[model samples]
Target: MSDATQNDERSQGVSRRGFVAGTGAVLGAAAIGGLGLPAQASAAEAATAASIDNGARVPVLIIGTGYGGSVTALRLAQAGVDVHMVEMGMAWDTPGSDGKIFAHTTKPDGRSFWLRTKTKQPLSNFLGFPIDQDIPKYTGILDAEEFSGITVYQGRGVGGGSLVNGGMAVTPKRENFSSVLPSVDVDEMYNTYYPRANAGLGVTNVDQRWWESANCYQYARVGRKHAERSGFPFVFVPNVYDWEYMKAEEAGTVPKSAVAGEILYGNNYGKKSLQKTYIAQAKATGKVTISTLHKVTSVSPAASGGGYTVAIDQINTSGDTVATKTVTADRVFFAAGSVGTTKLLVRLKATGALPNLSSEVGKGWGENGNVMCGRANHMWDATGKVQSSIPTAGIDNWAAGGAFAEVAPLPTGIETYASFYLSITKNPHRAEFTYNAATGKVDLNWQTAWKQDSINMAKSIFDKINKKEGTIYRTDLFGTYKIWGDHLTYHPLGGVVLNKATDNYGRLNGYQGLYVMDGSLIPGNATVNPFVTITALAERNIDKIITADLGR
Candidate 1:
């Protein structure tokens, strides 16, 4: 595979030295904390501040602080509605004993888990050896929440998924969007909400000039080289990480994050997560307040017809409940992600907390058909010695098959000529979450074999590339040499399906003041990365709700 055969973007780029030297002097001399956030007090101070106002009766209440929750809270607050959000996670703005907001992926500790004594790395192995370690249990960022047939990874903090993700902000293709979410108004999403969300989230594409020469993107270039050889189109995926800060890190100027292999944990700097974007803006409105470490256990119609009575538990970092309180809300929005919201709704319906919840409450759920596999490239490919953990490109073969695979980064900080990919495919194996009354738990009826369709869809792209590049699957990753990770998902979407479980705009079918506003409202799966869609949908729904329902 030669550079001559690739596109002009790949063939014509700055030299490696130019990438570093171009920004080295300029960024190195600039003030640190270029985002204007105070240096040491951000995480801890933010957490402490959000913990104020333990209980309140507000006009609007949001559960969880991810995209949906943050977006809804911000919009309602902007409309002069007093908003209170209850989050089960800790506030991530506080630094730990290490004086760091989060731990590094390569050197995970107490700051990497939710409350378990052991750390669960998404890439649990390297070269077929288990790489996880046992650490002291504490409240942490990334959560590998386990269930029967799957381990769903979620971020635990004020920013939700934004606290710990690859920061790949992607919207589903326009033509495919209709199938993924049939009830959504197409034009409103693409023309209004998507652009609005993108601008608010600070999503941007990598500069072609810098990507060509930067050592961090060498791994992406390798993936692009292989995809082109296999007749696949490599599309540039936008991200929330700041390009300037990334360049500064590569130039040895600002503190390193994405370029330093900090992902799936938390970025200490430069990533415009929800806490830095929507939630921060929401707080600025002064009408919105948040209570951290408070989980909404149940919500029932208030004796007075105008509101809901909510049950909450306030817990400490060690998962010890210190207080249980009740709060009333005029309107309640379930913004906990698909799993969390689904679990709450299912248990609420099954246990008689809210007996009138629709039967469709927990009917539709899927893993977004997520699967991971890697290819062992030839030494000549030379995926650089220093690789950026942030991915910038993907193999888009959705027309030929039902798969969109991102060219992921290894970021081992050493040359291995390895090609990595995390794929999202169309596997129609949706599961249902049934509440177990005896155990008071929510059970998902999903089987391991259910993922074979996803595996087959993903293999369609990799098989062609492997044959074209004369490479083979790496036996070390996921498990044995040729096996793929078929039982986990970082993108768990759907549960309370749209239009069926709720109205077109997320109003719960059976309740007047209740709504489902998170990824749970999405039916089954999204064709691409889901955060962008979640943000746009929240914006659209809240726009209608504010105009028609809530009065200032």
Candidate 2:
């Protein structure tokens, strides 16, 4: 398809203006035009028309424009609160000369950095390439030698991890959530937020009829057979791709899109990332002003008011850092994911920028014990192409008192290509986060028991799979044996957990105008994709803050 034709096709059903209006109205309470106000505002102006007498200072300033940050911003804005969003990545939708979107990792090798340089196709940041040799590489937050034994993938642009993560919108089982957070009501939370999240992100189930195709059906059949032989049942997985787009592809109106296949490389055709969803709407609010490429360096009590002064370093497109600006805000929400927020808070606490930070800022870190494993049938062709779309089924072994494992249909769906990957939940492993006195870098050191309880759970589930129709083989490991290797999760959580240092609702216990609302608030492993949960919890926390007018 010609570039112009493809662009037109993508924009066919939705206009830029319509998309923004719908998003803002649905997600936030602020009139679309109210988000552009400065940090300080009169109480009368900040309150929603319905609650004008509440007379509160705008309750939030969200940092990072990822899932949690985006949702929080939209909700607060919708409530008629003035919100300012700061991010370190440039906006997508607008493309460079090569028609590439900068969502993924940039390589040092020019050949791999630009999509035009390698595939001659339009690239979105969601589909990342290896860092080229010429680009400077940092050791980053995670320790490479301790986990996975490979370099980890992290997105540095606008949408954060959402840009490059598998667009699977799987919710954790209720038991899993209760196991880690016994106090929260999972059912009520799910009911309140799941639908909201789905609507905002345009989530839908892949059509079962579409799965009947050779590519989707064969592997699904294999999964069913294995489940029957092993005393397990296959359950369909919910995803976040546009079903209309899928239908168009099936009708031959669109090319074979990212649906029914792996989405990590980036789904040019399916899956909705935040940059296209919430961020776009936040901009339309006209009340919300986003400054991309502005990295927050420090935050402290404001000199002239009862709020905070945020020090930021603004970098230009050429990677030149210049001009430090101190922006003041009445309230601040830290949604910089688990790692980002934890790192910043740790530095602030150690350096005395925010000395009242609780001791729990860097504890209770867990990796959800993620271990990606898969098995192939003996008669199956091992080299056939695997399906690239998200997996549609999962084994509810966890509910039955076993391990967590989901079977995804491979991209090609041929018999030989048929492979089912499993994310085995492990016994909780505890990691500690500490700061280097000299380098100012945070350090994470984790240790776990060799015969952890979660491993035993995985083995029981694997035995059932082995008893079924397929010959089992595991590609990813936990520690050493197929049972021991620890898979690093895209969903890293805890560390600066809620209640430990902050209050039950994420407000810093003794501090004023400080709050955390991201993955860091999740106390431990959730045993599934955590984006939905993170966003939901953030929404809940923001509601409490606004209701109480805590910071104002």
Candidate 3:
């Protein structure tokens, strides 16, 4: 490995100037190739969907412009088929009141945040509203009334969860993938879809020089030393951010900062949200059309050949009156993440709007047993900013017959001294979501049956970290140890799952034209970031649909 690569492995923080200078040195050759495609496309050009067949209307209408939705749109458009996408959030533009292009934290004032207000009885914010409000609205998936105490951050702009999620791009361990998708050939899927998705999204490891100065790296080093002392191995994580930008930060060409630490809030810089990736490429195809701020209310069986008619409520940007529009499509793909897809399908099933819905519309929910842990160091060294770079290492104990654990650097900002942290503890948790018949809302009732496994995993990893001779500081227990039935990371999976609700290929089990391609199609928690999996599955499903022997 090069010095920069060695530095990254060692967990060194890089300055912004160092980052930029390193990027210029390393990326100059690669940038000369096709790297200019994304930059050549303006923000507007990147966000707009490409045009499909001009002679005929599209055969498919994808709802939501998220990871799954955008991927499906891109594949279909590439196949020369017409595709239209409807999104409930606004297009990503200049930063609004916050002075940032994206938002990571919720504003106290309701003006900037998104809330759920779709029902007569106004829901509370804890259930999942960005801001507390009494008005009836569709506040993403969480029950705003019940989750009032929790901060459930769901992105409402063009890219959906991709805009707000940590850019951690990890493939699930082989066992996890096999358990959830036993029928599909895991090796084939990985070989085919994994590289395709990564290429499309620009996945790369953090430049070593950047990690040389990053606070996250310092923390990782601490964790690694502790793990070594405890006989545990240190693992590096791969992410979906522009490593070039990271190098720029290290070289001081760019600001020694990130889109901002509220990664789950939103990244104004550094991170590559879907809006900047698949969505951007799909728009470049000139065949997809995306209508933002338009929410789909219902879908019904069209009188035509196994098609469907979608009812959407278009929210006026300037006024209160909502206009409804009915659009027809030969196929409808639901790629609105896990919660959004499940809620939509559940509501439709309950209301008899799409009576042919299968019995397994809403069930088998899992959270990939997500737990965030960290260790605090006593030293007061000025490590580089944490948010500007991504984690470069991970632990594979969980994947290799050992407890599931992955450690990475946590960006706690400068000045505050801290060591490495891990979003570790990767045992798949079994949870279920129930639709309340009386209220027409989905309630997530999670039980901690896998508590022992999770605790064991944490203890083993912590012990390993502590045993490392080079370790600094003790592993300090921080947030989210209680494992309450609280809302955690937004990587929700299952519910409207595959094989059961849909056919082996994601076609609705009973309905002819209905399809689902979002995280919901994932049979279980990924134990890693879910976006790449979701996108790859979307591609796989679209390919199966287009190649089917069924006459078009």
State the C-alpha lDDT per candidate: 0.81, 0.57, 0.59
On residues 1-552, what C-alpha lDDT tens digit does candidate 2 reach at each position? 755344333332222223233333322321221222211112212221221111223445678888878887777776777787777654443432233332112211121121112211111111022111222122111112223221123444567667656666776776567776566677867787666776777667878877666443455656666776688766777777776776666566775555334354344556688877877787677667666656788988866758887887765433356457677778888888777788788888888888889888888877665544455354433323434455666666776655667665444222233345555465566676777789877777655452255556666676667544434443321222343333345567888887787887888755787888788887657667777778777767777777786332
* Ranking according to lDDT, highest score first: 1, 3, 2
Q: Which candidate should be chosen as best, given TM-score against the real structure? A: 1
Reference-based lDDT, residue 120, model 2: 15
TM-score of each: 0.90, 0.75, 0.76
User: Which has the better lDDT: candidate 1, or candidate 2?
Assistant: 1
Off by over 4 Å in 3: 1-58, 97-99, 104-113, 116-153, 213-216, 256-262, 303-306, 316-321, 380-389, 399-414, 419-428, 448-453, 463-487, 549-552
Local accuracy of candidate 3 as per-residue lDDT tens digits, 321-429: 3566777778889977777888888888877887678888888766655544433333333333454435566655665433545554444343333343444445556
Question: Which stretch of 10 consecutive residues in model 2 shows the poorest summed lDDT?
Answer: 119-128
List model 1 lDDT by residue over 1-552, tens digit each.
543234212311222232234233323322121222223223533454445354457778899999999999998888888888888887777665556787766666666778877767777655555656666566667788888888999998898998888889998889999988898889989999999999989999989899998988888988888899889999998999888999999999988888878887788887889998999999999988888878889899887756888989877766777778888888999999999999999999998888888899888899888998877666567777577777888999887888999899876655555677899999898889999878878999878888898889999999998777766676566755646888799898999998998999999888988988899988778998899998899899899888888754
* Better-scoring candidate (TM-score), 1 or 2: 1
